[model samples]
Target: MKKLMISVVAAALVLTMAGCGSKDSGGTKVKFATDAAYAPMEYMDKDKVAGFDIDFLAEVMKEAGLAYSVTNTGWDTMLTSVQQGKEYQAGISSVSITDERKQTYDYTAPYFESTNMILVKEGSPIKSALDLKDKKVAVQISTTADTLMTKIMGGDNKSLKRMDNNTLALMELESNGVDAVVADIAIIREYVKNNPNKKFVSIADAKNFESEYYGILLPKGSDLKAKLDPAIKKVIENGKYATVYKKWFGQEPDTKKLLDQK
Candidate 1:
């Protein structure tokens, strides 16, 4: 009888240990990394992170019945932290979904569309892509804007000034350090809206600029994508996405058009 009791207790302990191991996977918490410097997408609001992406993800997590935490990992290391270091389960920092990135990282369905724009001070002569020839331009290094600018004006051009982030690039343009700043249209528009004193205008090259889609970054073969992609679709289908869209952008999103973009 003593041996039977011991075996039963041992089985109970094994069951307990198994339960503990599965706790986190049972939809309790997910940790995420993000670069909170990109406004209207993700940015620091005092000690807290706030923005369109933050709010959208919050809603998605709520719908999926999971608690989450976000760490403000800088843009340069955000992808590496998830893909190689395995530091976080996923990342969402307006990361563009490109063919190159797909090889190394898994991504949720594209959530946002973006395009490059050339931002110039109120009276700058750089009105178009052609006008940027031999003119000093500021852009965040390794960004889509940098890629586009390099293609427009050769990589050897001495006029290209690469900065670490969009804010710095815009600041350089404002200070007359560069003739113009090339960055995402949404980011430049948000900055200009908030800083009325610093008059900045964005010009788009309709024929030259290619639109890119943004997606959440996950480790290759991550099961998190299965959870997130469906949640994203649910948010769009239930009108929650439109509410968040209007809150940040001051207008409703073109639901049909954006959803159809792939």
Candidate 2:
């Protein structure tokens, strides 16, 4: 009888562990990879991650009845992780859903929109990407801005240097080591906020290549979209998304207008 009771207890423990680790029939635990260093979009505040993207995901997951977690694996790695399906189920690093990315991974409807801009030190001569010619410019490795820089400078501009993080690129601009840095406008705002003494300037919207925004990345042929699609639709309808948006971005997001046209 003693041996039988021990056997039953062991089975019960194994079942419990499996239950804890497995996703429910209608729910899934999404591992979201992002660059935790980008502020206002995604960043670490003390021990917790808090930013526009983080807060937006938390709300969307709750509405979808999905379990998810965010892992900081840098921007470049975040892209490859979802592609390889090594550690994450999706990515939320303000990744612009381009045709190239869509060829491999599915993207959800866009949750935000932005345009790239040039950030120069206060009172610098650098005014635009053209002005960056023959000048030292820092760009985050593998970002849209970095790609655009390559296109403008023949993909081998001697002055264009890649950095691991956008913040570091901005720092180079602050220290006067680089003439300018290229990144999204929203990210530039956050950088300037953190650097009080450094005044960053952006030229009026110049006609250049721009990137559209989208969320949701799944491994090729993954079935997670059924769950994410409904949650995104419901969140937009019930206004929970807007509430969360206001909390992070200080204004309501216009997701409905953009997604409606789709």
Q: TM-scores of the models, in the given order?
A: 0.87, 0.80
Clashing pairs in 2: none
Alpha-carbon lDDT of model 1 = 0.75
Model-by-model lDDT, in order?
0.75, 0.68
Please give the lDDT score for candidate 2: 0.68
Q: What tens-digit string does per-residue lDDT give for candidate 1 at 103-175?
A: 8888888887788888888887777887887899988887878877888889989899988678798889878
Residues 19-86, model 2: lDDT tens digits:
11223435555777776666787777775666877777766777666667777765556666777786
CA RMSD of all predictions: 12.7, 11.2
Name model 1 segments beyond 4 Å from true. Answer: 1-27
lDDT of 1 at 195: 88
